[model samples]
Every structure is written in structure tokens, then in C-alpha cells.
Target chain A: MRGLLFSAAICLATSPALSDPLPSWGSTENKSTIISFVESVTDPTSPDYVTPADRIAVFDNDGTLWGEQPVYFQLIYALDRLKTKAEADPSILTSDILRAAAEGDLETVAAGGVEGLLEILAVSHSGMSVDAFQDDVRAWLDEARHPTTDMRYDAMIYQPMLELLSYLRDEGFQTWIVSGGGVHFIRAFAESAYNIPPEQVIGSAGPTEYVDGQVMKLPGIDFVDDKEGKPVGIDSRIGKRPIIAGGNSDGDFAMLEYTTAGDGPRLGILVHHTDAEREFAYDREGHIGVLNRGLDEGPDRGWVIVDMARDWEQVWPE
Target chain B: MRGLLFSAAICLATSPALSDPLPSWGSTENKSTIISFVESVTDPTSPDYVTPADRIAVFDNDGTLWGEQPVYFQLIYALDRLKTKAEADPSILTSDILRAAAEGDLETVAAGGVEGLLEILAVSHSGMSVDAFQDDVRAWLDEARHPTTDMRYDAMIYQPMLELLSYLRDEGFQTWIVSGGGVHFIRAFAESAYNIPPEQVIGSAGPTEYVDGQVMKLPGIDFVDDKEGKPVGIDSRIGKRPIIAGGNSDGDFAMLEYTTAGDGPRLGILVHHTDAEREFAYDREGHIGVLNRGLDEGPDRGWVIVDMARDWEQVWPE
Candidate 1:
């Protein structure tokens, strides 16, 4: 369900007396476009009006909803898990890849590639019940702060994006996070951090097994919600193509392509992180959430490009 | 969204003058229990009250909601596809397995096992756009008839189950179909047949490929929503444990167990097809949707087993 405040408030961009729906977003094209699209779609008198059930909006998580600088946050969580598990059992360090991961040997871990990453992930996440895994993730998220800025990871979420999500929800839209990150990790905090419940969060998943009357995580990746996989996930899980989709990277290119390509009044958006003064700025050669092709073709493809440096009055949520 | 009738519905089980919500269901405990459960959960003053958003109920499609006897309709559709394709491109008949499948050789197909079945599915389903596949399924459903009964496959759906679905929806519940059937096949008629939109149908899925800027079905089965996979699929897709679950096979044991094991007012139901005169009755030795373990352990586990011979007043919709 949408939040209780949804029915409790009325948001009008033209009315100065009403609450500003997107306070953190500057009065730029990015902000106005969002307000206009929502208003036109929700107006009962307009032909562009969409029913509440058809008002679906999907967002990418890693770099779009939260910071993914230095490296992807999930990778950091996996590395930390290696250290903690090794300290407890030490026997888990017997595997060469696990041992390297435990020792913080990034070079060796990188050399192992997808196979090595999956091996490390298996060791770190498997052998636990679904509840236990969720609890473990919750506990870690509560304490884990970004190394660069020392801010809690949830606090690193973009203020403007948060406003946009809430505003969309207020307009009778069912907002969803379509992420490339691990599903369980995102589920643990998404409800609290984004007000988007676990049910509405779609992401990459590790295989799950039901053993001894409990659902447990398995070693290997079952589905990846990156690149082309996003549309697949949306079709299978949501069973409907989203009318509005936003992401910050090329990994989400297909998702944006699929979402906006649908008939009539669809919105596709990209967040361009060009604010080096606030957050790290890298695109073509960025280690995470590379925005190369999206940047080059975004305007040509009719996607709204939110220039992070110019579109926002603030970045991270305080 | 639940239908608009829900807002207009005012259910009071005690009132005799009100229109019977489930006209196809007899006054047996199977029907009464369902009504009572719904009443208690929906009563504002009752301790069993569950909010509208939390009133999630899941149903299995194959046998519980519709007929799966004489082989699943999806398999039949796949076989028809094999024959039609073999006619167009005679060279496709060269593969022994494909030829056997096209010839309706059940003995040989069964001997080929799950791997062989997937091979047949890949050949039958792949290389088509999502829209094209959906249209193909819709066309097949329109013309395909049961071999013996000569009834349209969709016409074989249990009237009582359809009433239950609508009644549950009328009670402010979000009804979902969690099946082992292919989602596309179900989506083609689910809304028309049961009033359930595609967004609420979860099923076995093949991998999806994004090609030529369109999402298309890939050849192989990516995940099977049977046995242990039921609970896993429910967790990933619904993101919440359903309060009520129903099915007709041992394959659904995990789903019923998981749904009812949770705290608070929960219900597990099994549809026992014991009416040989109206519908085929088979249990332990049946080829499809066998009901051996669920029949034996249902009562002990507090599951409500509906005897089709006694509980249903009407079998199929007139």
C-alpha cells in the first residue's frame, strides 16, 4: 500500500500554499518535467489520465537511489562477510578464493573474475535460513557506514530521488525499485530506507532452496537484474511493463528502453552524476554503474537526463 | 487492483436474505469455513482482522482452479506447436525427440525425463517475440478443445473456485495464482476467466532475452515453480508470505506448509477431486496432479480438504 500521508496530503506544483513536492530538486527542467508528467497523467479531465492500477514506476537502486562510489556496496558487504566468517570458523579460509577474499586481496579477488566472485558470494551468503540472512543483513546495514564519508549507507541516498519516489506514490503510482543489487540485502532495508516494501523491490537473486521446512539461500546466482535482465525480471515478477523507469547507468539501458518504448505517455529518465564537488564523478570508465552509452544516446532516445550538478539543490539526505 | 464490487460488497454470513456470494458452492463446511474465515478477518472489531493490503491469498492453477487431467493444457499447446512447425519446415521433424513429441508419443516423451521435456519446451516456445507468443497462446485457447469432453480448455475451470476467487476479491483480498504452469499461457485468459490480472500470476518461467530492442522468450526453463520452488517463488515474487494457500498435489505441500505455519489466522486448503461422475477422480496413481500425501496429512496439519463429490453444487460454469 502507499503510505498513509498519500491520502492525507494534496500536492500541487502551481499552488504556492501547498507543500513543495520536491524541495531538494532545483526548479529546473528535471523537476518541472516530473511534476507536469504526473499531473497530466492523473488529471481525470485529460485524455492522458492513467488509472491508479496502471500507474507503475520503477527505479534502479545501486547508483540511482543510493551512492555506489569506490565500488558497489554489495561487493563491500561480501568482502566484510569474508572477514567476519573467517574470524569465526577460520576453516572457511581453506578455499583459495575465500582465503584471498578474507585477506582483503582485491587483486586476487578481481583475477578470480565472475567464478571467483560467485565463490566468495556463496561462502558469505549460503548455509543460512532466509530469516537469518535477512536479520544478518539488517544488522550489518545498521552499523555499516561508507568508508569515504563515514555516513550510514541509508543516509547516502539522494534527497531528490527520494522526493521523486514519494511524489510519484502520492500521484497514485506504485513505485518499485528494479535493482541490479542482491535481492535479500535490498529487502532488509528498502522498506525502512525508501518506504518501498520488499514486495515492490525486484533485484538480482541467488538460488533459493527449501530444506527442512525452511527457505535457504543457495550458492550461485539464479537471475541477474542487470542490463537486459531488468526487463525480464519486470515481466516475470511484476507481470507488467512499467510506465515510468529511471536509472543512472548503462546496466539499466534495456530497462529504460523497454519501459519508455511502450505505447503512450511513458517516461524514461537517467541521472548523470557530474557533481565532482559533492559526489565522485565518473562515467565511461567508471568501475560501477558505467553511464557511457546512456550518456551518448539519452537525449536522442528521448530520455530525460538529470544533470546531477545542476538539477539538485542538495545531494545526500541529511 | 481488486474489482470495484469489493467496495459495494457488505458480507454478513448470518443474513439469509442477502445474495449468496458463492452460488456454485454447497452449504458444506468447505464453503462455510471459507466464508467464516473471510468474515472474521474482515470484521473491524474482530481480533482476526487483517488489513486489506495484508489480505493476500494464493491459489494453485493446474488442478485446484482448473482441469489438468489428460495432461496439462500447456503441454498440449506445446505439442500442437511442434506439429504445426514440423509441417512448415519438414526438416525440424528430423530430430528424434521433436518427432516423437510432434507425434504425441507419450511413452517416449515420459522416458526422456525432465531434461527431455525442457528440450521439447525450448523447441516449442523459443524464437518468438513476447507479444507474438502471447497472441499464439490466446489463439490456441480460443480453439483448443479437450480430446474426450470436446469442451474448450478454459470452459473446464471449476465454477466453485471462480466464485471463491471473486468472493475473496470482494472481501478486500488481493488474490494471486501461484502455479507450476507457464505464466504466458495463464495470462492469456486469467483476467477473462478468473478476474485475476497478469500481475498476480506467478509461475514457472523460461529465461527472457532482449533482442532487436524487444523482450523475447529464451529456449530453456530458468526456474520451475514446483515442489520446493513454490515457496521460493512466492517469497521472491510476492515478497510476503501469503495468509491462505490452496492446491491439489504433493508438489504443493511446501507451499501449504509455509503459508499455514505462519502466526495469526492462516488457512490451508486442498481440493479433493472425488466426484468421478462430474470430473475424473484420481489420487495416488494419477498421472497429473496426484493427491496422495496431501490427502493423508491434510487433517493432521489443520488443512481444510474440500471433497469435490460433496462440496460443489455445480462443477463447471454454465
Candidate 2:
């Protein structure tokens, strides 16, 4: 009888209803707000109830889901790949920007600006089959580590964000990743890292050609899924406005605005990275993931600005 | 006792396992092949068993799903819209092609060729918000009927194909529509007509802009999801090659080839429209959806050419 009672207690404690849905989220107003929003939309009796089919939650990939300090992870992968290619064929690094990128000269590459960055990306990412490029990305992810943290890129994914994703999915919301990063680059690890499927990911893409039977990535910019492009990407890809939009920078401001501006119940979340001890912290003046406009007007728009240092009990998974 | 037995009998007759999954499909080789392929992939004991996540099935929309006879339904819609716009402002129809389209002169428009057709499509389809365009399409679909059949375009959807879709879905395969038609146009009716969602429907798209807060359609082709473009679009959008591909035209040749060429068990289906009594029968030499390459190579590639007149017991929903 005692054994039975003990077992029952254990079951009760571990049960889905009793257990914390977002264990990494600290006991804060933001946590409660997120839970309340999800519950209100999921409860059939609630006026804010949304159908499972209509319960879409979109998230930005870089910085929002994982760390993107120093540089975007995709750029790191591209530079590393470019270096290997240049070693095999030195003529491939014709331009100074290409040579700088291949040599891991971040300062010189940064000075080259957007055009040079695009050129480097096009040269590094294209000329290979889509299958081959994805394979290379997978291989790099398996071997590569972050410059500062010495941790695998996938391992840097936010534990709190993962919990939020699971909780939303538990409440019948479909989670999608809308990123300014390369679509192919994000797709390579999104499923395993964040539980987001390839089809559910929308991002900047380059032109691809179907040569014989294989689809080959081509040299050139096709579309940029950033800033104003975020809204356009969401509309074209998902064909439905998300009920919830989560991001960490101004790149996602349009996405969050578009989502919240829709009729009925909506929520916009901006993860303010302020945990200098656990994770890198920079926002207003940062070169990457600058949050000037978002920081200024987010609170006024009824958007929840989450302080990572205060709201998260844990940064990364155990 | 008699009533109870009768109730039991009715239950057995109506049971999913006992009832025919594809009742509209005749007891043909094509039907058997489809069933066998689905069962093989779904059965855990089978060597060809595929996980649910990888069980993707792609389908072409237009003539493959419904009728594209007199012309593509979208062109018909475009002409009708052009006529209305011309009525409001006669100056809008400045070009010869535009005037011909507005006056329902399809012969003259056809003579104007692809360039003229694109011009007509751009003028009629663009310069409106995505939401407004979809709403306009919905309104048009509600009132419009086929000039010859006098049946609603949505009603002309194949019954056998509908059953096939439901069956594949039951077997845990995700169904997607890869069409050459306008993405916005197909999205308007796809959900209601085929039980396929807007996001699952990939098609040719025009440029869109994010103005103020709305995603407005702009004049110009963004990407054409036809011929070789089909494979490119599938790769960019879905990010996975489908296990099963169904199409009725040369435009889908690349897509079908790409799917079948992928490693492991795969199936390609070509719907041969031989049901002149119920639908259009033109194929190899038809102006739209020409199947010169498909008809010649399909059999050699182990593709199941579905003879609509013989394989289907019913053409359209009653």
C-alpha cells in the first residue's frame, strides 16, 4: 500500500498537467503572460480561443533561437568552407573580399560591407548541388565549435525558447522559423536543433537550377528575408498571419508588427539578451542584431520585451 | 435480436477496414499499384516502410486535379477581371493584347503568345493587397462557371483523386500541390476544393511589397513553378523530395523525375486524360499541358499512367 501511494505521488508530480511546461522560464511576469496567452487561445470556452488550424506561431532563427554574437553562424560556415575550397583551388579567391573571408579576417570582411558579404556568400554557397551543400553544412556542424563558448552551434540553442516551442505545440500551435539567415543553412539543423521542420522554415534564398536531375545552387541573390522582407516572406510562404511572433532583433520587428496588427488575440515577444555572465549581451549599439527601433517602440505596441537575464532560469540545455 | 444483427451488419459494412478506400476508382491495375505502394510504405513490417516525416506526396493542380480544357481557369478569371477593369477605365486597355483579353478575344490573345499572356496576367493579378486579391478570386469563383461544362471550376475536381488524397493522408503521407498556376490564385480555392492548405500549395508567384502594414502584389513574375522550375521551387519551398509525385503534363516532368530519381522506394503517377465523355482528352498535342515527353518516357521510368476513362468509375463528385 505504501509503495502504491509513493508511485502515485511520483506519477502526479511528473504528469504533464502538474509539471512545468516551460521549466527554463523563471517565475516572472513574462512567463505568466506567455502561459496566459497560450491558455486563453487554446481554451475553447475563452473568447480569445483560436482553432488549432489557425494557431500559428512564427520565430526568428538567429539570436532568437540560438546565439549569433561575433558573426552569424552561417557566415562562419561559409568562411570555413571558402577556406577549404581556396586551399584546393587558389584561383577561386580572386577578389580581396573573398581572400579576406577565406583567411578568417573578420575585420577586413566586415569593412567590405553588404555587397562584399553577398559576393562572398554567393561564391562560397553556390556552384554545388543542394544535396552536397546540405551535407557539407551537416558535416561542419558535427565538427565545428563556437569561437567564444567552445560549444557546438546547435548546443547554443536557448533552453527557454525550446520549452516555449514545445508548450505552444502542446497547445496545438504550429511553430515555424522565419529567419534572415540562409534558408538552406537553417534547414540543415532546424529539425534536430529546434524541432522545426524544413518546410516550416522561411529565409533568404539564392537561385537554384535543376541540372539534369540534380538541383544546383547558383551564384546570385534571389530574395532577402529581412526587415520589411520578413512580412512579405511570411505572407508568401505561410499564407496566414501568425498568432504569435518571437524575435531578438529589429530584423524581426516587421514580422512581430505584422502578427500583432492582425485581428483577435495576438502576442509579440522580443528576447532582450542582457545576460552578460551566461551569454553575450548587446542590443542598441550592436553591429549584428541591432534593436534600436524595436527597443524604442516595442513596449508601447503591447509587445512583451523579455529580459533574458531576469526571465530565464537556465540559458542552455543540460 | 433482428434489429441488433442489422445494426452490426451496417457497422461492418461502413467500417474503414472493410469499405473500399478508393470507391471512385475502378478495380484497375493503376488502383492496385497505388494501394500497394501506399501499403508498402506505411506497413512497419515492410522493407520499403518510410517514416511519417518523410512520407511526402506531391500533386499538380490544373488539369491533373480539375479541368484546364478551353484554357487554364486562371486565364479565364484574368480575362473576366480585365473586362470588368476595362469597363471602369477604358484607358487601362491601351495595348492590343490587353484590349483583346478584355474583349474575351482568346484567339487573338493566344496569337500574342507567352509575352502577351504574361502582360495580361500581370495587369489582372497585381496592384492589390494579397488579402484583397484572394477575396476577389473567392468572389469570382463563387459566380463563375466553365463556358462549356457550365459547372463550377471547384466542382470539376476529380473524385478518384480526392479519394486518393484522403487515403494517402490516412496513411500518414503529407499531401502537397505543386502547380504552374499562380500561387495566390490556387491558394484561394485549394483548401475548400482539395483539402490542401495554402502553405502546402506551391505555384508561380509575382513580386509582392510590404507597404505600410499590408503585403501588396506588384507587377512582374517572381518565380515560375513550371518545367525545370518545378524541381527548383519544390527544393526551395518543401526542402524535401516527395516519395510520390502525380502530374498530367510535361511541366511536371522534372518534378516527377526528381522525385523518382531520389534514393529508396518512390512512385510517379501520370494521369492520362482519356475520358472524353466526362472530360477533355487532349494530351500529347494539346496547346496547354502538352505531354510529349511524359507519355513517351513515363512507362520506361516505371511510372503508372492512370487511364482516367478506364481507371475511374466516377469522374467528378455527384
Candidate 3:
């Protein structure tokens, strides 16, 4: 039994499948520049060196780290939730978003705008305890498939960004996600997906209340953590100003501003989605993942605008 | 030069202060019981073992981790802020709390109850960005001394609790301070004083808003994070339900209840302030730090009620 167990263990340890390395995304000048700057800051002998305490890096979620092609993944979750709820409660069909969602016309529902989105979200998100909501998110992620990609939303995460997160961690940098998405929803998957722990994820939050005689937290959509609230959420949650920040839109402009304004070897990179072949390519005029003012002003502010067409060889995990 | 450097390094490495073993605080029966329970749950070989990912411990700040006599430390900070603000604008003297504050009568102002406290906290905590508030907290902590003890507020922390935090961390437990005090105020000292990071500190928070192009997160007097809010804040911020909880008042009873109700080997401890000679001995009917319901029902619920007078040889750091 011992000899058989030893052989099995040796096979497991040396197996090609178990030891398979992460796919290589050919390096670019942009990647090298980012790596070099981080190296200088992390190296103790360097003049611009920073300690582990000072090594804070923030990344935007939607288009920057993951594919946000067929609308935001959160919106899709909200839509599916709307459909399910509508089936249980026929009265929900009277709601405009629900009606559109029941018909599977996501485009029409989205076109109904922010109010429509908020209505869908408020109904789907509220009335559940925080733990219940987390479990719901975990369950949904486990089974929910993206509409366009037909893959698990988590698997659609950009492989290159995952590599960056790992590389930064190896260099003692604490990585964080500063998103406009719901804090708890992202927190549920961030740890297992990116290796960034829940404590490090700062995002949109709602007011929460405890039910009497229960150990549950319920979230109410009172505060949307986007635009100016992005910087605020980061300040309130992380306390430390980020030394490195990555984002893809004008919504993330404030975070980029706050991070780059800090003294020291700071870095601000904007992932410009300009690959129409593999991904969408629209900067100033794109309705989804809009990058208007940020694209116009990034070069002047010394922020590197990552051209997706030229920079990344692949966008999603194989 | 190399030979001399090597000799100096060797001498420093072999220095008595670096090499000599320190004396142990003879682990009493109480300490052993607590350590043994924690070890059994945390040790993988033990049947009751818990994973490191699930090892969560929560602590109360004020009277449990530190001394909060004569006045709550944050209240003292508020009074000082009131005096400073009043000095600049004598018009603030028209306010009841400010008037009492100006006359050096804090008890009179506080007697107005929660409303009075809120007024004082509003003027003291608001109208500043989160970063500015943190800086002010740091500055105040540096200069401020406790009224009765004449010691720095940070120094008033119980040395045993500080050791407990380190011990818990060494045993793979993530320790958090879930207090009724302002989160940022506790966060300012927690990292340096107890090694608990800012993200791990959850407290009563006032509604925060974005004003004048900056994010202002302030404490509101209305949102007392006591009673029901304790569990609410814990669930919202920590995400994971704590396995171990330490507290001292009726305000913390809800937290203890929330923690102990979890499955498996959980521990809940209540610190009874029974050391009038060394500290202060007042509970149940006491106006401050009341421990009425918890004291009576703790044992029935399997919570360990720590008798401070009898259980501890030392209170605060000398």
C-alpha cells in the first residue's frame, strides 16, 4: 500500500497536466515598462524603492481585467434573476425591465437606461441577507453562462491580467479591485478568481441593516460606487492611496487621478479596448465601456493608454 | 572593511537582547483553557479542526481591549475638537455642548444624551475628507493624553489583549475589532498598537457623502453600531461569520450571540470589569459600559465570563 501510494504521489507531483504552466501572452513594451517600474519600487537597493506596506495596486474590473462585451456581467446576473422572479410572480411582468427580460430582449431593457438597470438590480439584490446574497452570487456564478461567450463568467476573465496579479503578488505588492460593481458580489469570486482577497476588493456598496433576532446582513441599494464614489470607496475601505491603478473608462478617471497624484514612482494605465476583431473597438464614442475624457487626456498626464489591438495577443482564457 | 563588517554583523546577531530567551507569563489555568480550545479547533490533526480560511476572531475595543474610563477616548478627542473649534468661533458657544465644553463641564453636555453626543461628533468629525480626518486623528493621538491616567490613550490598551491579538495571528486566526466607536478612529491606532489592519476594523459609521469634489466619510451619532448593528456591521465588513468573539458590555451581547450560534467549536468570552482597585468595577446598573443582560445570561449560553479582578494580574501596560 505504501509503495502504491508513493508511486501515485510521485505521478501526481510530476504529471504534465498538474505542472502545466500558465499560457504565455507575448510581452510588449508596455508590459515591460510596467514590470520595470514595479521592480524598481520593490527592490530595496533602488532609490525609488518602497516597502511592502507602501506597495498598493488597484485594478478596475469590467473591461480592464475581464470581458465586458455582452453588457456587464452583473447586469446579466440581474437580468437572469429578473426572469426567474418573473416566472414565480406574474405581477413582475408589469414592470418594464421584467417584461423585456422575460422576452429575452436584453438590448431593449438596457436601452431603457440607468433607471431600468437600477429597477432590475434593486428587485434582484434586496430582500436577501448579505450571506444569502453571497451564496446566491456563488451559486449563480457556478451555473450561470455568459450570453455571448457561452462560458462561465469567471472563466471569461483575461488571462494576462491574472498573470499580472500573480506577478505583482510575487513582488510583495497587495493587489485590489476598485469596481463600480456590487462589493459583495465581486468579493464572492475575487478571492478564488484573482487571488485578491475579499478585504482588498473596494466597490459599489448599499446601506445594510440587520434584522432583529437574526445574524444576517441585508444590503439596500442606496449608494452606487461609481464615478466620484470610486475614489471615495477606495479611501474609505483601503485607507492607503494606490501606487498603481488600472482602468478602462472615464468612470475610472477619478481613481486614476487620485492614484497618479500621489508622490513617488506612481503608474496609471488605461486599457483602451481598440481590438474590434477579438473585442469591441470604440473609445470616445462607445456606449458600453466608454472612455471619453480619459482617452483624450491620458497621454498628457503620462498615463499609458494600453492599445488592446497592439498590446494583447489574447483577451480571454482558453 | 569586509572583515570588520562581518565581525560587527556576527556581534549584532549574537547580542544578548537578540539571542536571549524572554521569560514566559506562566500560562495560568484560564490561559491554558483558552489556548487549548483554540488549538484543538485550529490544529488539523484534531477532530474539531477548522481551516485557516474559516478562522475568524472578533474583539471589542473600548473596555475590552483598552481602558475607557473617565470618558471614552473618542469622546475626549471630540471635546478637544469642540474646544479648538469654539476658540476660533465663539458663536459655537451658543450650542449646548459647546457651552458646556467651554465651561470645562463635559458631564453636563453629555447628560443631554445621544443628541448632545451627536452634535459634538458632527462638528468634530464632519466637513473633512476621509484622508484629512485620518491625519487629524493621527495628530490628536500623538499629542493627546488621557485625563485621569495622564497616559497616551494608545498606552491605556491592556497588554494581555495585545498579546492575545499576536497569539491569535500566530495561530492563523484573522483578528478584527468590531466596536461601537468610529471605524477610522480605531483604525488609526489598531495597526501600530495591536497589529490589526484597518480593513479588519468595523465600527458604527455615520452616513458618508461626496461634497465639493471629494469623498467625506464621517461618523453620525444616529447610527450607533451597538446592539443589532454590531452583527450587521460584522456581516457587512468581515463577510465571514466570526468563530471567536471577546467583548465586555450589553452592547456586545448581540455580537457574542451571532458568533456563538455558528456551528462547531466556537468561543465567546465576556470581560467583567470587576477590578475597582486596579481598574473600575461597575456593571448592570452602571451608566457607562453596562453589562446587565449579558452578565446574567452568558453562562447559560456557554459564554465564558472573564472576572477581570481575579483573572488578571496586570491590567494596563505599566
Candidate 4:
């Protein structure tokens, strides 16, 4: 009995937790094609075998990894923060946007313009150490609710991509989020939400200052990683060209370009938000999550366009 | 005969250059110790077995991986560029530092202050795409010589570290350079000198701008990855905490701290410049490559302090 116990312990220590295959929850002909191609490349016996060194994969954060409906969850969190601060000190009420946010009128505040949104984001995100800001993000995420779904912001993350991350890890691929969002904001919840650690999350950042032995990372009005900056961020951060790139909009076009340029069996995937009934769907004309250029070039670039309406069996977790 | 011909074709198609363990041209003890540690971690049956995902290793650029004697090679390159620009414009001669740089008196230029160095770096580095900057760096490095060594800066690199990089790669460790120097400067020669590709080189950067249809990465007056910024850079870029971190100066303290704080078996090494005969040895008070606080706390922190005077046989490539 002791020998058997010892053997079980040895096995447990030696073997890593075997991750499940890429979520086929959104099973479709397109998804199957991608899975098969990836499997072939990873198989050592196959002619298209890729070594682990060449197995880098990158994912877009917003529409690709999680839902960005009604409003960006971070923006909502910022608005709430602004409201609370205003309640504490009525001086914030002097601003038109802050007054709108205080009244819980998100549409009016949002319609006030990018300047107004920047004002809210700057005030809420500035003047804190990265550690402190992360703690705040964690606290807010734990307590805050989505204005529409009422689900936790983290819960709104797509189930398919979460499965995809696990599947990729199992296949010896390192996955990273190359997003235009705040790096720390996503990094705080990435581990809990998707099993990705803080180091693996790359995003836009403001200038960080080391003051009095504390490192304070402030949200810069200047976006560090966005649009064309996406490719630059990936280049600066990952240093390796990703073999697989997935996204839903033009923000990811440069990333797709950079990834597909690698000399290997590369995959570029674009998630098309086509299911209006199950989830929000607005493409081409939509201000947010625009997918026009990517949609048009999908066929020419050999990018797999995942039709959410047809592909996903379920969108979010129960 | 047909079967033999088919076999030959298959071999030709599948042949990736067979990688061999290179001889680490160091004393028997250092070579043996390095080899044994690498072998143990690589062996699947060993207790220290590290999977490819966890096998990230980082190297310091200046003195640890390469020779930075007399002066940093990048600074030399910047000074040279400054001289060339001054020769063309003559108006650049208005500044005392520019005049000093034009005269090839680096000490005089450096004495002018950090602001002087910033002025030289800004004009020499700004107004180019990262690709263009990399190309310029490559062009300069291909011909630039170490004033003291009278050898190409590429040839001035430590051979043991080159061997270590190749050896780690063989053992499934992804090698990266976390330097306080310019990213483009290191990237220009990393691929050819250390066999590390451009993407794996992370270094100090300036603000970049994307305007109209062109992307321009300007060398910022403010350095992005330096001192405490080392860990921030590593966290921001590589997204993986290094399992092994090596450095020569106090600048790498934060990187060592971050690397050692990781949840697995980790190694932190400090290269002490004790060999004044082969290489300049002036730590604590040295202007370049100073190993002050690192030397003091290295023993307490359990960091392996490699005394160049006693530990290394060769300082530079033969």
C-alpha cells in the first residue's frame, strides 16, 4: 500500500495538469479546420511539425477573448469610480460628464465625447502604485455589476476562448493578450479569468514613475498599445512573431499582419460578431468592435472568419 | 535504387540543422558546473525537470553577455553618429557637448552631464521607424570598432555566454536579453552575435509615434527600461518571469529581484569585474558597469557572484 501511494505521488509530481482540447463548444466547420491544422503542426511525426520554440500564439482582448457589450467593462468601472469620488467630494460634479455619471446616465456621459471619457479614465486611474491599482481593480471586479447583464465583468468573458487558452497551453503554446486596454487592468483578473498570469498580459500603459521607493503607474492620456501600436507592442514585448493571431476588428490588423508574416504554418482568425439575438452584433457601421477591413481581407489573407451566429453553441458561462 | 532516392529526398526535406553542444571555453570547474546544472534541469527523469513553458532564461547585455570595456558600445555608436551629424551641419558645433563629441573626446562630452548624453542620443536615435533604426544599427555595428580593443564590437562579446545561450536553447530554454541599452542597438547585432533574434532583445526605449500612414519610433529623452524599470520591462515585454537572470551591474537589481521571486526553482547570477588584467576592474566607484549594491547583498540573497578574476579564464572571444 505504501509503494502504491509513493508511485501515485511520483506520477502526480511528474505530470502536469493535462489541459483540455480547444473548446469545441463553438464547434463549426471553420473551427474544426483550424483545430486540425494546429494539431498537424504540433504533431512531431507530421511533416509540418513545429518545435515548441515556434509555437507562439497571440489573442486580442476585447471581442475576441471577452464580451464588450453596452460598454467596455473597464469604462463602466471607471464611471462608477468617478461617481463614488464625486459623491465623496462634490467638486467633481462641476464637470458635465461627471454630473451625468453621478446621475447614473451612462449614455449621456458617453455621448459627451472622447474628451469626457478621457477625463473620467484619467481621474479614476491616476495617482496610484501599480500594486494599489491592481488591488482596486480586484475589489471593483469582485463587487461591481454589468449595467445590462448584471453578471460580474469577468463572468462575461467568452467561454470558447477560455477553453482555447487551456487547449493551446496543453499543446505547448504560450498564449498572450496583445490588447489596447490598460495592461494592469487586464493583468489583475487575467489569471483568475483565463488562467493566464500577470506577466502574459500585454496592453496599453501610461508612464510609470518611481517616487519615494514606490512605483506609481499612472494612466497616460497617450495610448501606449493600440491599433498600429498593437504590432509595435507585440514586437516590443513578445519579441517573437506569433505563429497564430486572433482578433475581431481593425485594431488587430497589424497583429494579424505581423503574425502571418512569420515563415511557418501560421493561423490568423477573426471572430465575426454576427449573432444579434444571442449577443450584440454590429459590424462595419458600428463605432465599437468594427470589423470591416478584417472582414473584407479575410478571404484574401487566408484568415479563418468565425461566424459567431453559426459557430458558438453557447456564448457565456452559466 | 528508387527507395534509396526517395529516402534521400525525405532526409533533405526534413533536415533542420542538427544542433550540437558547443564546447564552453572556460575552466573545467565553471564549464562542468554550468553543464551539469543545465543537464539536470533538461533531464525528464530528474526532480529539477523544467518544461519548455517554464524554461525561460535571461542574460544581461553589457558585460555579462558581451564586452563593455572602455565604454558601452552603443554610447560609442551614438557619439560617432553625433560626430557625423555635426560635421555635416556645423550648427551642431554651437553646443559644447556636440563640439566635444565631434572632437571624439567622449570624457569631455560625458562630463557635460546626462543632459549632454541625452542630446547626443536624441538626434542620433530619433525620427526613424524601428526597422530603419535597426538597419542603421546593423550597418554601424558591421564596421564599428572598439577603440581600445581594436576589434569589431561583435567579436568583443564573451564566448562562454554565447555557448550558454546555445546550450540553454538546446535544453528548451528561451533566452532573452534584458538590457538598459536601446532595444534597436542591441537587436541590431543580437541575432548575428549571440544567435538571439531581434524579438528576444528587450531594452530601453523612447516614445514612438504613428502619424499619417507611417510609423516612427523616436528615441525618447526619458529612458523606459532602467534601474527599477528592469523588472517592469521584463514584466511588460517578455510576460514571463525568467528562471535564470544574469547581470553585471546594480542596474539589474530589480530584474534579479523579480526573477528570483518567481514560484519555481530560480537562479540569479552577478558577474563581478574583478579581473583588471584582462578586463578593467573598478566596481563600487566605477562610472561604467558598476557592481555596488549587487555585490554587497549578493551573498545574503544567495545569488551566485561570479568573480571574473578567479572564475573566468577568458574575458573576450579569441
Q: Whose DockQ is greatest here? A: 2
Better of 1 and 4 by lDDT: 1
- Each candidate's number of clashing pairs is 0, 0, 2, 3
Better of 2 and 4 by DockQ: 2
Per-residue error for B102 in candidate 3, Å, reads 3.0
Show pairs that collide, candidate 3. Answer: A130-A217, B206-B220
lDDT of 1 at A244: 95
Give the TM-scores of the predictions, in the order they appear: 0.91, 0.96, 0.88, 0.76
For residues A30-93, could you state the per-residue lDDT of candidate 3 as single tens digits? Answer: 7767777877997789999998977889999999888787678887787778788888887867
Off by over 4 Å in 2: A1-15, B1-16
Model 1 per-residue lDDT tens digits across residues A1-318: 254234334333434326788999998987888888888898999888888878999999988999998878888888998899889989888678888999988789888888999999998888897788889887888888899899888788999999899888877899999999988889888988899987788999998887766788889988889999998888877777788999999999999999988887888999998899998787888467789889899899888999999998999887
| Tens digits of per-residue lDDT for model 4, A1-318 | 466557667776744344325554555678777777778888889988998866888998988898887767788778788878888998867677878877779788769887787767777887887678889999999998876778888998877777777778877988889887888789888988988876578888766664443456665554557687877777666656688999998888878877786676888999989888877787797557888899898879899888888887778866
Every candidate's CA RMSD = 4.2, 3.8, 5.6, 7.3
DockQ by candidate, in order? 0.60, 0.71, 0.38, 0.22
lDDT tens readout by residue for model 1, B1-318: 243234334333434336688898889877878888888988989999998878989999999999988888889999999888888887876567778998999778778888778888887888887778888988998888999789999889999999888888878888999899988778888888888988889899888887655779888888889888899988888777788999999989999999988778989999988988998787788578888889889999889999998999899999
Each model's TM-score for chain A is: 0.93, 0.95, 0.87, 0.89
Task: Kindly report which residue pairs in candidate 2 clash with one another.
Answer: none
What would the TM-score be for candidate 4 when compared with the true structure?
A: 0.76
Query: How good is the docking of model 2, by CAPRI class?
Result: medium
Real contacts recovered, all predictions: 0.66, 0.68, 0.36, 0.29
Please state the error at residue A315 of candidate 1 in Å.
2.6
